[model samples]
Target: MNKIRIGVLSTARIGRTKVIPGMQRAKRCEVTAICSRNEEAARRAAEELNIPKAYGSYAKLLADPDIDAVYIPLPNHLHVEWTLKAMAKGKHVLCEKPMGLNDGEVNRLINATALDPGVKVMEAFMYRFHPQWVETKRLVDQGAIGKPTSIQSFFSYFNADPDNIRNKADMGGGGLMDIGCYQVSLSRLLFNAQPRRAFGWMDKDPEFGTDRTFSGMLDFGGRLSTFTCSTQLAPYQRVNVLGEKGRIEIIIPFNAPPDAPTEILLQQNGETRTITFDACDQYTLQADAFAEAVLEDKPVPISIMDTFANQHTVDALFKSAQSDHWENC
Candidate 1:
């Protein structure tokens, strides 16, 4: 079988630490080129990652005939721009999540892909690829959850630096965009419905004009999901699912180490059952799936529906926060 030749669009932390390494370990992906706005950084990353070539600009790397795919770990705002650029060059694109800053941006992105037949575009969502979630989703759909009632989740970390992109309102910064987004995405995954109304409160830094904390509720049909996403809170990441039958809690749900055991605590009729996935690196699994999708000419099992739903909910919440009341999503 031929390998999928992938170009690294940026040497960002995700590329250097998680994505590049995962691609190297996957069966069907080859890291052909890495590019950076800074030539020195690109050269350094190419050397460290053992990639064959380095380019000083993303445009240069995209023009390389050997690159069949491009992995974009760019900022939230740059996602649409480069994904379109890559697709225009006849390369498939795997972008980091949020897809884009808002629904409009994602719509524009999909519009750009309409003209291409050989290429495809997808947003990287490693959590859904992990066996834990696949099993959880199966159980939920199998009536283990028994008509989901309400959900509570959070992704919080203190990024004390006010100047960081995560804290800048202009650059799509905030707790909501950073950690909070995961909660919203996972909630939709559990509820499997688009939220109709949203209400939220955000605490902003007067000096920076960006939010330090965000707490919100999404009304998905009859199920209401509450989320706390903040950059000021002490480090905590978890997901809790509630149903008519019982409840469950996932600790360190998003980024568990490969082969690291993950617990799924379930409660029903005052009796508790604990299950564990022995160990899995969701990132590696995610990379492998993307490669298979390209090589097999198959559609990804996970769809853009939930990704778009999450983006819609998040966009409404921000608008509601600005309006100081509930907003129709």
Candidate 2:
């Protein structure tokens, strides 16, 4: 197929506002169908997004032979279950991150993928596909940053709504699972290695029983990464990658605006330069990249094994927070 015929698993806000629109812009993707448990909701979204098909239940969407792949934007807890089901029906999957609740859940998905070798499964970390990040990785690898040693990131937003999925612990809600996973993923991406150990501190919401504020440190042997994420705080996000001779700072790391230009700062030898990237949707890039991989039978940009490692580190950080000590990743 010239373009991968895609099906979206839900009418989730992220899918409706960001991922679906972005995928619609991709040349290699055709968002053919959308489904939600509520038939009316599915119809409304399908009409709004101009999708050709709508289904009240996920099973109906999965059974459609025309859909070459499925994008799962369900809550954290439902990610692995629906992803596995889609794969079982011979549909490729692009799942939203923190792909599983814990390492064991991630492992189960991993083993399932191994059994279904023909299918492609990838965790959606769209920020990695942004041009600014693409440029940052290039600069780091080319010695523009002079052997990166430390990475720091902060992501936060104020959301106290008890009804929101992100505030419900049973649905895998919290600052860490929702936003902190980006920090963990990017640290590994930049360091090009797994952390030896992890240390974490968290403040749980009394009523919600979910971590509202969390800070973690990853010891990457010689280098280190630290981050703080919060569900109740002023909204802000930034990432700084430091090296012996230089540093790179991302102004808006996550939730980058697709319609506006992005900027990054590079500092070296008492000089700083602002690198500007034209407005482009990372989601489109990500969708097209995944479509290319599926069409060409090539390995995905981010593997399930990489997802496992990221979750393992997150799991270790959680353990460290509870034990109040360093835990091996």
Candidate 3:
């Protein structure tokens, strides 16, 4: 097939406003359907996005034989359940980040995929597909920053709405799972290895009973990475990669604007250089990459093993927070 048929599993804001639109623009995939628990909402989103079909329930959408793949933009708690269901139905999956709540959930997915090895599954970490990030990784590998040793990141936004899924702790809602995962994922990416140990500090919101702010450190033997994420703070995000001889700073790392140019600063020998990337949707790149993997019968860009490793690191950080000491990853 020249183009893979994709079905979106929800009317989540991220799907309607970001992922679906980007997938629609991808060359290797077509978003043919969208579904929601509420029939009216499903129909509304389908109509707005010009999708061919809308289903009232997720199972109904998954049952559609026409769909070769499914994108799960569901909440944190629902990720593993729906992904396993999709795999059972012989559908490729592109599930959103923080693939599962903990190591146990991740292991369940790992074991299930082992049984159905043909079905490709990937965690949606779209930032890594952006040209800026691609270039950053290339430069790091080429030793633009000699002997990379440390990374620091900060991501935060103000959201006090109790009704929002992010504030619902039972549903696996929290700043750490929502945004802090990015820090862990990128650290492993740049370090080209997993951290040996992790340490974390968290401040929970009394009303929400969810972590509103979180800070963590990952020790990759001689290298170190630190990050702070918040759900109740001024909107901001930036990442700095420091090496023995140079440093790289990402001005707006995570939520890169699709229409505007993005820039990164590279400093060396008392001079700073700005590297700019043209306007492009990382989501589109990510969708096309996953579609190519599905069409070519190749491994997905971010493997399930990598997803499990990231979750393992996150689990370690949470353990460290509770134990008030370092935890092995």
Model 1: per-residue Cα lDDT over 101-178, one tens digit each: 898888786667556655777778778887778877777777786788888888888877865777777777788877
Residue lDDT tens for model 2, 1-329:
79999999999999999999999999998999999999999999999999999999999999999999999999999999999899999999999998999999999988998898789999999999999999999999999989999999999999999999999999999999999999999999999999999999999999999999999999999899999999999999999999999999999999999999999999999899999999999999999999998999999999999999999999999999999999999
What pairs collide in candidate 2? Answer: none
What lDDT, from 0 to 1, does candidate 3 have? 0.96
Q: How many residue pairs clash in each candidate?
A: 2, 0, 0
Off by over 4 Å in 3: none
Q: Give the lDDT ranking, best first.
A: 2, 3, 1
Better-scoring candidate (TM-score), 1 or 2: 2
What's each prediction's TM-score?
0.95, 0.99, 0.99
Candidate 1: lDDT of 13?
Answer: 89
Best by lDDT: 2
User: 9, model 1: CA deviation in Å?
Assistant: 0.9
Model 1, runs deviating above 4 Å: none
User: C-alpha displacement of 188 in model 1, angstroms?
Assistant: 1.3
lDDT of model 1, residue 33? 94
Quantify all predictions' global Cα lDDT against the true fold: 0.83, 0.96, 0.96
